[model samples]
Target chain A: MTRLLLPQIGVEPPERCDAARNRRLLLDAAALLVSERGVDAVTMDAVACKAGVGKGTVFRRFGSRSGLMLALLDHSERELQQAFMFGPPPLGPGADPVERLIAYGRARIATVEVEGEVRRAAENSPGTRFSAPARAVSVTHVVSLLREAGVEGDHELLACSLLAPLEATLVLHEIRDLGMSTERLEAAWEDLVRRVTRA
Target chain B: MTRLLLPQIGVEPPERCDAARNRRLLLDAAALLVSERGVDAVTMDAVACKAGVGKGTVFRRFGSRSGLMLALLDHSERELQQAFMFGPPPLGPGADPVERLIAYGRARIATVEVEGEVRRAAENSPGTRFSAPARAVSVTHVVSLLREAGVEGDHELLACSLLAPLEATLVLHEIRDLGMSTERLEAAWEDLVRRVTRA
Candidate 1:
């Protein structure tokens, strides 16, 4: 999917260069807080303290904790999207479709390990779970790769099937509630990809 | 997968045979309301009126609207479970494992078409989604079938991947929002099963 064609979220006006930089700084601080102490530790005050900015600045930039959380998730999703769409193999342009698909699954599993709480929060609302533009983009990418790999079936539904196990909600349950390790999850995903893509 | 070993839901005291009969009557009324109108139309008053019982009887039996919805879902799940585990061929004992798995997916899609709202409501709650005993039983059944089909490598996760597309929430969205037909979804699912189980 083209970046220019992607849907814009939220109704915020365009930011000046410095304002955009400041927003990134606050989101980075919030992400660091999430990584260091979990999602609950990302209170406005904590993010403000972590970013060395006033609490008022944090609120002014993101509006609320949930807003900040959403922004952080969007930022992370865009980064992954860019890596797969443009960055080097095997997750990007240079590798075979099957290898790229495997890399995509691994990258998604890794992302969930870090941003699971945030992703689950976003998904908790029923309407947003499958309808999010980011989700659509991911599905489109997967479908493209499946077609490129010459799999002769319904690629759209096949992509959905492949992407389902990588969902944050299920992945988090498998890891936190079922106590499966990240490496094990990734290996299982790789196996699934091979099974589907093999002749 | 045995009915006797299945986890029972709710904690009401055992009902006398007559009370059990009354409860079945009430549930049948509720199911009819759901089918004829929609899930939203299955109010307590409507169920009581449909069943030719007092409104108090509906409340006494189900406690609340959500309670009635859960019971209806449980009733439906039990029926499907029985059919797959003990009833006729393809879905039950006397068919090839691959055909049984395909039958299971087709049956689940048909159920969701009828009971999507109730199933989505039950699945919306995070704590209940993956942890429900009914879900566990379904997953175990799929895993067992995959092993029976002689598919190698992470049968448990593969079963999860297969079942994810059949989830009510996602299936509902595909049918309603995306305008995909149930026939199309079932065909795609059959294709998916064949791909995963193909030698």
Candidate 2:
């Protein structure tokens, strides 16, 4: 529960349970709406109606449509980050660097494949998603794996480079505009991971 | 000798020799001005004066500053493409697939390092540069190497994935905003290429 930061001000936490429930409902409704009609059609009133919450609740939960989109993106990214960091053997702690790297990339590809539209909407919005904590988490995870693999290079740059292939814009471009298949994308990731983790 | 396309129009043949020479002069002057005072400070009349060409010649050669900037980007990308395609081994056609892939990444990093400002300007411009012949050429080269390496993935997607690391915006962000060293970038590229082309 990170406090929402505002210019020259910070909000206190200990949010009411009801208010938190309403927020969750609003986000769920918004995600449903986006899946049904894309980001453009997911209005505040519509979300409120879908969630059985008041319009004010929707607005309070996320100040605007862009804010709502950001919240959803943050939520999705956080869950994915947690899974990669602590959940399983291959993607988390116990696996070898090569296997973990492959697991990580495949996991990322699956995340993007599931949340691709929301991710694209967030990216097309003005700011902040790329610099978010989730992105930092992913970079740190990749760098750690690179070190474990004995990659004798700038691990930080290598991490960024590894993540570059997963950029929303490029992924969307490949899937939507270029008629590329997700199977192909997955295979490419496997190839990339193999090449990168080779001794 | 590729035809340059005007906005909303089909491509046209190369401009006459004299026009090309004048365009070159204007571009050189504009580059100098931009280096000294940034892209915003360079002007048509200033470029004309610096190049010892008439203002009308500058206008005729480049239509406007935006057009001139695009021409310069196209020019640089073309030269780099030519060098990699025909000039020498490693970066050129004479090297093995794995070596060529490494060279391509290194060459692209060097290109972004040298003409970085120009690449950034092009990146910030509206519309995608995917359709550019330079991009097409690079894609073709990468696809050829992927084939040569017997990589079992969609050649198009894999080539793009490999190229994702070399994107101008990402590269510039890493170097300029993150205070990353060029050595770090080159090393990362080497690591990436080795990973991408490994058997």
All candidates: DockQ: 0.75, 0.49
True contacts kept of each: 0.80, 0.66
The lDDT values for all models are 0.85, 0.72
Q: Residues B1-199, candidate 2: write the lDDT tens digits.
A: 1112112122358878987677677777887776677666668888888888788888877798878877777777766776766669787776777787888787777767556667766644324545555666777778877787787666887788778778777787787778887777887777677766666
How would the docking of model 1 be graded? medium
Tens digits of lDDT, candidate 2, A1-199: 0111111111239669987777777878887887777767788888989989788877877898878877888777766666665668687677888788888877767766557778866544324435555666777778878787887767888788888888776786777778877777877887777767677
Q: Which ten residues in a row have the lowest lDDT in candidate 2 chain A?
A: A1-10
Question: Across the candidates, what are chain A's individual TM-scores?
Answer: 0.91, 0.85
What tens-digit string does per-residue lDDT give for candidate 1 at A1-199?
4334434444357889999999989988888888789888989999999999999999998899888888988888888888888789999887899999999999999988568888988877897899887898888888888877888888888888888888888899989988989898899988888878887
CA RMSD of each candidate after superposition:
2.6, 5.4
On the 0 to 100 scale, the lDDT of residue B150 in model 1 is 88
